[model samples]
Target: MAPKRRRTVDNESKEAVQNRSSMVTRSRSAKYVKISDNNNSPVVVFAHGAGAPSSSEWMIRWKNLLADSLNAVEVVTFDYPYISQRKPPPKAEKLIEFHSDIVKMTAAKYPHHPLILAGKSMGSRVSCMVAAENGIRASAVVCLGYPLKGSKGAIRDEPLLQLTVPTMFVQGTKDGLCSLESLEVVMKKMKAVSKLHVVENGDHSMKIAKKNLELAGISQEEAEQSAVQAIAMFVSQTIGAM
Candidate 1:
């Protein structure tokens, strides 16, 4: 009798199958796309804060700012499954898994370019968890309004400690959700190359008082522009180092 040959499973095909099977059937949250002028530029995958969808005003504005000002970066934003549903938000571990899957899918789609994981609040926390667990290396991570801890709660320090990629935390000086003091302590313990940019008198949503804005002779639009410029500069420097 002739020896029978065994067929090896194709890893790529297997992944595709798993991805398809794991997708949620319901339309939970929305996904938005902003294309950049520079073709083949690096991609910035953004995750929104808890309870907010990708179409939220903040995410839309950030996407536009990055796409228009960054020159060579495309921005993609997606909502977590929990937020996609009208139900309560998922637990942190579940959110992390969702973020990881989104990153993997985004990377697979744009295999030619590097990825930068950028998130706001809870989204940023989830991004950090994904990056650490998968050993995925991004050009950099832009954490906008990172939530170090909730009010009257103990802070989660593991994500910052385990991060190995270049990270920039853009925070408001007066953010109540995550205090500046707590963030400063956490930043000191981060293992990765990290920098913090504090927006003077800004709140948890990075919104400053109208009086201050007027005094600075800057509009809300201008503040957003400044933030985009800062992010672009950080990305440029981090990519250069790589």
Candidate 2:
């Protein structure tokens, strides 16, 4: 009998199976958080403020709020070294590399989705700096109560000026750290397109004073909901333009 013919079809099928298995293993190893069941939705990498860890109640609340408002598939939040290691917080510049790494990893896991960098006060400032860095192609940035002033009340406009990506600022009218009037001036100087949503009488944390809430005839939840809605609109417009 002639030499048995090699089973080319079987060999090819076996190779294909191995390739698929490898892909599955890689997928399983990649870390990611799913905020919604929707596929290919935007991914938000949210950083916490210097005073709080990623697990803080405040961070948790806003993370969920952002996911719902932006229709994001994932909202990834990571604690900085200080928060995670119980060390003193470092300068915002010092945290940029680590923050960029998290953003990159999250982007890699959701390669098909748009990336949005967002954060509270100090975190928001850092996010802007990271967004301005090389190789971070964030679709947009959401700055929740951006700290436009330093400890000594000096303007901190460098990061905002450096941003090349569209940005949305949800600022509190009552936030001493970022006066709306001063932000207006800074926004005028910024090179990137920027939008603002003023939270009347809200503090640095977007917390509306109970008295102010009563005066405005709206509940705290309602005010926050309105802010989130504004963010949604900003995100939609930004993505649509892109």
lDDT of each: 0.68, 0.77
Write one digit per residue (lDDT tens) for candidate 1, span 1-242. 11111111112243423343342122112122322444436788888888578899888988777666555446888877766468877656688776887788788887777688988888888888887875575777888888887546878778888988878777776787777667766665677777665565678778889887666555556555556656776676666566
RMSD, candidate 2, Å: 19.8
RMSD of 1: 18.2
Looking at model 1, report the run of 10 residues with the lowest lDDT sum.
Answer: 1-10
What is the overall TM-score of model 2 with all chains considered together? 0.83
Error of 2 at 157 (Å): 0.4
- Candidate 2's C-alpha runs over 4 A off are 1-40
TM-scores of the candidates are 0.79, 0.83
Clashing pairs in 2: none
Query: Which structure among the candidates has the greatest TM-score?
Result: 2
